[model samples]
Target: MKIRISKATIVDERHPDNGKKRDILIENGKITKIAASIKTEVDKVIESEGLCVSIGWMDMRANFRDPGDEQKEDLESGLKAAANGGFTAVALMPSTNPPIDNKGAVEYLLNRAKSGKVQVVPIGTISKKRAGESLAEMYDMYRAGAKAFSDDKESISESGLLHRALLYTKNFDATVIHFPYDATLIPNGQINEGVQSTLLGLKGIPAIAEEMMVARDLTLLEYTNGRLHLGPVSSAMSIKRIASAKKDGLRITCETTAAHIAYSENELENFDTNFKVLPPLRSEQNRKELIKLLKSGKIDVISSDHSPEDEEHKKLEFDYANFGMASIESFFPVLYTAVGSSMDLAKLVATFSINPRRILDLEIPEIKEGVRANLTLFSISEKTVFEKMNLKTKGYNVAEIGKELNGKVLAIFS
Candidate 1:
């Protein structure tokens, strides 16, 4: 899909080499030339207005229930949701019914995702069956195109087992995406452990559960010297520990979800299960610190963490409900609300697009001349009311369900 983007602000977050605001000519999927008003023959020309064009966005964590759990979400529908959410690449987590523990399942999902327009990289399970007992077939799964290893929604605790998995993934020179939570402390917890939980009479997931586990993982990472991506670090204490680890020169990076930045556990006061999530939301101070880390480059990436659950799972009582949210549709909009007004566009693009692609060691083409038009076009000022009609995921659970937000994903080019 060759096209000439005229009068477009080329925001290649990866390449500070290419100065911003230039007309680009994309020919045969490679950036051909980047210049001011290039006179080139092309099939089509795009008149971009009020648009920030950048290299494709990448979501480091997203759960698309394909293969055995298609009733919740299939590969095709998940890819559509991703595309509409302005993502060109998504890392699929291994939390399916059968779990992506073996090479065959890894191959199946890799092939299935390749059939879609977006690049869907499946993450292999860190533990066999995600039971936290034994390690999965990491070598075979890596051979089958699994980019990283994780247990999806939770940490593979059992210290001995996680230590072995980390060392094994180190053998493949692949990063481990640890979910950073101690399941023992969070048994039956419905929301963040705080005053709100006491008022609502709901079980609480203590923030220390996340911080303690993260602290342990960082120590192991220091000893192992392997790439580690601490995914969805939800607490301020965890953030401080990770920041300190990075300063001490650990080969580690971390990310937080879009919802983590926009909302806190206070939303759970109404006993709304939709606001419930694993490693549940913390205090406003925690949210502010997360934003600070993202802006300061301490936190490496931002993802949708788009875990989807059906109506049967979400509409139940808070304790009976599942821990997940459908953020594939709300990711970009929620981000705009967090820092769009204060931070510059380049930093935002770096968090959403450049950092994640770099973390996966994927090839990132600059938004320059003669490149294939793999890009995301969005307006940070466009406002839209989020509802069922606006959501593409089968799951409608979100903290900002009816809240007004200031951004919209116009299109995704792959």
Candidate 2:
């Protein structure tokens, strides 16, 4: 159905100054006209008063476990969750059982996502099968529509191997997302390494485990003159490292998960498996530093990280429980709750909408005339509760579950 949105506040995010109330026209899946007081003739019209119109949100890192573990989470369910979150594009991580290492898997994901409303960009695996030993067929996968390459679940800390992958991806002018973690430094660590771990009687994942790899990765990136992306970087020190690297003009970008920004090791006192995650949550001080860094333009993007685990895996003891949360549905409201009023609506849209597209080198869809009708409508004043059972994904392990949240995604068009 063709529709026109009138009297809506527009916030493009990429350009904060352009945010103001305006009338927008949409027809045949493309934005036809946008002005302050445009006369629109359409079969349907939406009088968006308090709601804000902006470019569609993009989740730079999402693990939709299809083509292998659909029961955990599939492409269809993931897209539904994304649409519900006001996202129009998602970068699918390659952490499936076989991993997205070859051309066949890339094509399958592209075709599958083509049938959906949201755009899905396949992320190829940097290491074959995510083994961290041999490099995957980067050239072949890139040709098959892989926007970027990453080993989502684990990090390739091996210096020599990572160097090879970086140089290999350079041929295609694509970025290789690195999961920064030093295996030896972080052995069997459950939560963040701190007083919380000691009081809770749990193994600790040291901050150095993440910071060390990030230091090395930045150095290698400089030497190879290749693009490097730090995915879901959790540690405070890691953010500092990335900031320093960027200051030096290193071609590096970083993203932090919503969990990392909202909660901290303090959430682990209840022994909640949903609080556990890769590069586990850090102290409150670390959480504040991350938020500050995001405001300072150090962190380039924010993501869902969206790892899905079965009940058997998350319902067990804290140590044996899986480390992740299903965050797609709760991503926006939770983040808004965390950074409400501190950053204006324009900056908020920038983090979720335009920044992600820039990081992945995607063409940012504009709110002007003649662009695709790709947009998200939302109201920052609204609030809702996070009910796990009501979520679309099979994975119900989320720290924000059952919590009341602000900012609701009203609709998404793509």
Candidate 3:
């Protein structure tokens, strides 16, 4: 597909074209020209004054209910949503009916995703069947192209199981991702435990539930000396602990979602089910502290924890609704506006592009000559509204509907 993008500002901090507005010519899936005022004809021309280009974005965590629950989302639709969000790659959580706990499942995901523009990297579950019991075949899945191992949304309560899994992955340097939360602490939790929950009269999920789990995981990391990834550390206290752990040189890294940084518990005041998420949104101070962690480089990546729940499951009573928010396509725009007051464009691009691939140990692409075109064409000034009609996912659990924001995904070259 030959394409020419004229007057697109390059926002990638890794290359020399950081802030330059120049014409880029791509042919046969490779960048052919990136010089000033290039006279060329191509199959397509994407010219806009607000145009911006950067290294392709990647999301480290997203749940697509394929293979078992195709009514919610399949690989094809999920990847389409990902591409619409400007992500060239997305790491899928192993939360399917028959969870990806073996080599066959990993190979299945890779093969099934070959038709999509977005690359799907399956994250094998930490325990067999994601039961939080016996360890799964980590080495087997790793050899089968599993990028990371995680029991998505399931905390490993067994200290010995977590310890053993961590140590086992050391042989291949595979990361064991733990969703930090002590299930025992928030048994009947529905909303974040705070003033907002008090007014809404909903069961509260305490922040300490996540805090204690993070503390426990850090201790296990020290004891086993294993590669551990503490995903989506949401609270101020949790960030403090992770910062301290990093200072202690523990083999640990952490990230937070775009939603966490933007919205908070107050979003649930209307009893909107779409805003209901695990490790539910925290206080205003906590959200600011999360953004501060990004500014200080304590947080590693900013991902869209895009979990799509069907309308039937989402449009129920607050207590009975499934936990999720549909925001893959509107992710960049929503995030760009939400954090524009504080975050610079360069830093945001780095967090979205450069840091994620580093955390997953994947190849990072540079927007330069001689490299294949793995890029996201975007506009930071374009206005966007994330309504039901614009949603690309099969599900309809949109939390930010009617959200007016900046930054739109013009196109993606994968």
By TM-score, the best candidate is 3
In order, candidate lDDTs are 0.80, 0.84, 0.86
Candidate 3 displacement at residue 16 in angstroms? 2.1
lDDT of 2 by residue, 260-300 (tens): 89989998888888888887899999999988888777878
lDDT of 3 by residue, 227-340 (tens): 888876678898789889989999788878888988899888899898898779999888988887788888887888888988899999999998887768878987887787
Ten contiguous residues with the weakest lDDT in model 1:
12-21
Candidate scoring better on lDDT of 2 and 3? 3
For candidate 1, the per-residue lDDT at 37 reads 73
lDDT of 2 at 172: 76
Task: Select the stronger candidate by TM-score from 1 and 2.
Answer: 2
Per-residue accuracy of model 1 over 120-173 as CA lDDT, tens digit each:
888899888999898889899998888888997767777787788778887778
Q: Any runs in candidate 2 off by more than 4 Å, and if so which?
A: 15-17, 38-49
How close is every model to the real structure, measured as TM-score?
A: 0.94, 0.96, 0.97
**Pairwise TM-score winner, candidates 1 and 3:** 3
Candidate 1: list runs displaced more than 4 Å: 16-19, 27-30, 38-49, 398-401
| Clash pairs detected, candidate 3 | none
What is candidate 2's TM-score against the reference?
Answer: 0.96
- The Cα error of candidate 2 at residue 235, in Å, is 1.8
